[model samples]
Structures are given as structure tokens and as C-alpha cells.
Target: MPKKALIAWGGWPGHTPEQSAKVVRSLLERNGFDVTLGEGTVMFADPKLASFDLIVPVITMSTIEKAELQNLVLAVRQGSGLGGFHGTMCDSFRSETDYQFMTGGQWVAHPGDIIDYTVAVTRPDDPITSGVSDFAYRSEQYYMHVDPGNEVLATTTFTDAHFPGIGGVVMPVVWKRRYGAGKVFYSALGHNADEFAVPEMALIVERGLVWAAR
Candidate 1:
């Protein structure tokens, strides 16, 4: 049977959640997944959430009810894979520490807001990044507080121009971790749907999603 995927999107409009969802849904479908699209967090409250092989959240800076959040958490913990990009995953529930803990990071700020930067493939041998070379792009360079246990696949260096304190600091651009038996993947690259048009960025995210699926 084909793997099932659920994509729930809705939050800050500036991030173009709907457009991003459509882009991701297409990718998933093309990859042989049975995709379901949802409009809000209420979809997360589904008791059958764990039935899907993968869950993708395109929401940004939005709130989820306690029950809905808990259900999503339980689904992942019980072996439902969770994967997403940018603020949708890391910046979704700011007040929920458990959600952040499971995701392996949280977006704190973008130092320069749509600045040019290079993404270095730190783990080129890894399946998710193999054969993909380092590439440069113009987008929000996310500065995130990440979990030490995460296996970082790609990273970027921050300069002193924007945040002096983080000068020369390396930040994880893509990573994957395990929550219970579930695989969790994330990338701090997609600022909008159009950003995925960058070949390298799109490939990395597509590979990450497949790797994260249950």
C-alpha cells in the first residue's frame, strides 16, 4: 500500500501557507503518497492522525488547542512521521515546549530578513543530502534554537553584520531526529512557495520528507 500523508496548513498569510501546502502536496503525490489536504489545526485533532504515514504542517505563528496539539504529539510519538519546512514546523506553536522538543528546534529570528547566504551540506554522505552540492540563495536565514540530539545534514554560517553576537556561528539548515519510533525532519529554507523553485532547496526538502515518512 502507498504511504498516506496529511498536510494541514493555515496561519500567518505572509508566509503563503496555502501556496506552500499546494507545492508540498504535489511533491508528496508525485512521490507515490496518498495525500490529504486540510485547512486548519482542527484537522490535527483527528483521532486517526496516527494512521497516516506522514504529517506536514504548513502553519506559521499560530496556536493549536491543547487536545489538538496533544493528539499530534501522540501520533508522532507512536510512530507517525512528522516533516515540514521553515516556520511551519519550528515557528508554529511558540508557547508549546513539547512541540518544539519533538521538532528539534524553534525559530527565534531571521537576522537580516531575506539575505543571501550559502547552505553547506554537512552530511553529504547521508541519503537526504547525498549528491547535492552546497548552494546559495536569497531568503530568510533562520536562526533557531536546536536540540543537541538532532543529526544535522546542512548548515549555514552567520556573519556579524546582522547579529554581532552570533558572528561566525554555524546554524543548522536541515536536520532529522527521532521522536519515539517516528522520524522527524525539518529545513529552515523555505520562506515561501517560490523559494522551493531553487533546485537544491527543493531537492533537499523532497528527500527529507521521504526519509521522514513512516
Candidate 2:
């Protein structure tokens, strides 16, 4: 049977969650996944959430009800893979520590807004980043508080031009981790669907999604 994937997208229109969802859905479908698309955190209330092979959240800065949040958490903890990019995964549910802990990071700032930056493939030997080289692009360079346990696949160095305190700090751009038996993947790239148009950026996220799926 083909892998099942669910994409729930909504919240902060500035991030273009819907357009991002379309990009992700197309990739998932092309990769032989049975994809389902929905809106908002309400989908998390589904009791069968754990049955899907993968769950992708394209939402940004939205509140999730405690019950819905708990359901999503239980699904991942019990082996449903969770994967996402940009503010959707990292910036969602800011008040929920458990969600942040599971996703492996939370966005804190994008100092220069849309700025030119380079993404370095830190784990070129890893399947999710293999054969991928460092690439430069103009977008929100997310400064996030990431989990120490994450297996970082990509990173970017912050320059003093924006935040002096964080200058010289290398931030994780892409990473994957294990939540119970589930695989969790995330990328700080992709503020918009256009960002994913970058061949390297698109490939990394596509491969990461497949790798994260159970």
C-alpha cells in the first residue's frame, strides 16, 4: 500500500500556507503518497490521525486547542511521522511547550526580514541531504531555538549585520529527530512557495518528507 499523508494548512496568511501546501501536496503525490488536504487545527481532532504515515502542518502562528494539540502529540508519539517547513511548524502554537519540544525548534526572530543567506549542507552523507551542496537565496533567515537532540542536516551562519549578539552563530536550517517511534523532520527555509522553487531547497524538503514518513 502507498504511504498516507495528511496536510493541514491555515493561519497567518502572510506565510502563504495554502500555496505552500499545494507545493508539498504535489511533491507527496508525485512520490506515491495518498494525500489529504485540510484547513486549520481542527483536523488534529481526528481520532485516526495516528493511522497516517505522515502529517504535514503548513500553519503559522495559530492556536491549537488543548485537546487537538494532545491528539496530534499522541499520534506522533505513537509513530505517526510529522514533517514541515518554515514558520508553519516552528512558529505554530507558541504557548505549547510540548509541541515545540516535539517539533525540535521554535522560531525566535528573522532579524533582517528577507535577506540573502547561504544554506550549508552539514550532513551531506545523510539521505535527506546527500549530493546537495550549499546554496544561497534571499528569504527570511530564521533564528530558532532548536533541540540539542536534533540531527542537523543543514546550517547557516548569522552575520553581525542584523543581530550583533547572534553574529557568527550557526543556526540549524534543517534537522530531523525521533519522537518516540515517530520520525520528525523540519526545515527553517520556505517562507513562501517561491522559496521552495530553489532546486536545492525543494529537493531537501521533498527528500526529508519521504525520509520522515513511516
| Span of 10 residues, lowest total lDDT, candidate 1 | 160-169
lDDT by residue for model 2 (1-214), tens: 9999999999999999999999999999999999999999999999999999999999999999999999999999999999999999999999999999999999999999999999999999999999998999799999999999999999999999987888899999999999998999999999998888799989999999999999
Error of 2 at 182 (Å): 0.4
For candidate 1, lDDT tens digit of each residue in 53-162?
Answer: 99999999999999999999999999999999999889999999999999999999998898999999999999999999999989999999999999999999999998
- Residue 50 in candidate 2 has what lDDT? 96
Q: Against the correct fold, how does model 1 do in TM-score?
A: 0.99
- When summed lDDT is taken over every stretch of 10 residues in candidate 2, the lowest stretch is 159-168
Enumerate clash totals for all models, in the order shown: 0, 0
- Per-model CA lDDT versus the true structure: 0.95, 0.95
In model 2, what lDDT does residue 173 have?
Answer: 96
